[model samples]
Target: MKWYSLMPGILLLGLAGCQNFPALYSSAKPQITTEKIEQLSEYGAKFATEYNRAAQKTCTKYTRLYQQGDWRAGWVLALQVSATNNKHCLDNTAAIQILETLESQKKIDPELLWLTQVHLNWLKELEQQTKSVSQLKRAANRKQSRVNELVKENQDLVEKLEALKAIETSINQ
Candidate 1:
């Protein structure tokens, strides 16, 4: 009989401890300095100290979301951070494996499923474009190097021929 009374009080305490849930998704909290992206636009997405701080802050948010069992949100932040910042703070690969696992679970909300697919497709396309551009640059460099070597070889040959003709003229004299 005493245990029943104690249980209600204990349960209330437990529920009260979860009060931070509202804060987790709070709309009132102003965005931190590390969360802003406008500075990145000014820098043309180049490396800067601000990016490192933002990446670290984003990584922390991802971690907090994962700890709260909000895996989808965590993966979103991870992907955004990876795409926008240098890899010194967070890996550029992002939550690829997590999203793949999420894809297999048909229980996910339709909107999230669509969003994940979009990110995956975009990432894959970007990677392919980067690879193609790199290969073209490499080919261009190789062509220029070969052209320079041929020019140098031809110059050497011309000089040798001139010297041989002078020696022949001297012998005739």
Candidate 2:
């Protein structure tokens, strides 16, 4: 057959192999069952309730600290509460962000400000320590690998020595 005559057939076959055009062009909306929607709503309600409870408890503790005139303790408790809430409840990071902003604005007392700086420095030290620990762990791993290699080499040398002894004994006999 002539090339031009086969071109139309090749083009049609290529298009057919590309994708399912009917499914792609279908107008039907995706079906979501009512059971799944109900389950999602229930989960959302439970999560909201739990988050509210955690938030209320954190607020109550912070308020008590504030009323007791331990502003530094209250500030630290606020941080702890935020961290705890972030870990267990909704993942809101507003507490730290607000604290940092307030610190930058110089609104906190001098003692609390000093404590914040110390806390930041301590966090930096912790990061450095973690890095050092990781480096030590890697060094230990390398040493262990070297030890394993030395053990394997020693085992090979011992086997060779035994074989040499066996050959020497046979010759002597």
Taking every candidate in turn, the Cα RMSD to the unseen true structure, in Å, is 20.2, 20.1
Q: Pick the candidate with the highest lDDT.
A: 1
Per-model TM values vs. the true structure: 0.50, 0.44
The true-versus-predicted C-alpha distance at residue 170 of model 2, in Å, is 0.7
Taking the tens digit of each residue's C-alpha lDDT, what string does model 1 give over 32-145?
454233542333233333445575665565567666776555455445544543453333255555566566755335534666787767766666787899999999999999
Question: lDDT (0-100) at residue 156 of candidate 1?
Answer: 99
| Residue-by-residue lDDT tens digits, candidate 2, 21-132 | 5665657755656775575456445534644678566555554655576444334443443243344321124334445655776755543466566655555555567689
lDDT values of the candidates? 0.61, 0.59
Assess the local accuracy of residue 135 in candidate 1 as a C-alpha lDDT between 0 and 100: 100
Candidate 2 Cα RMSD (Å): 20.1
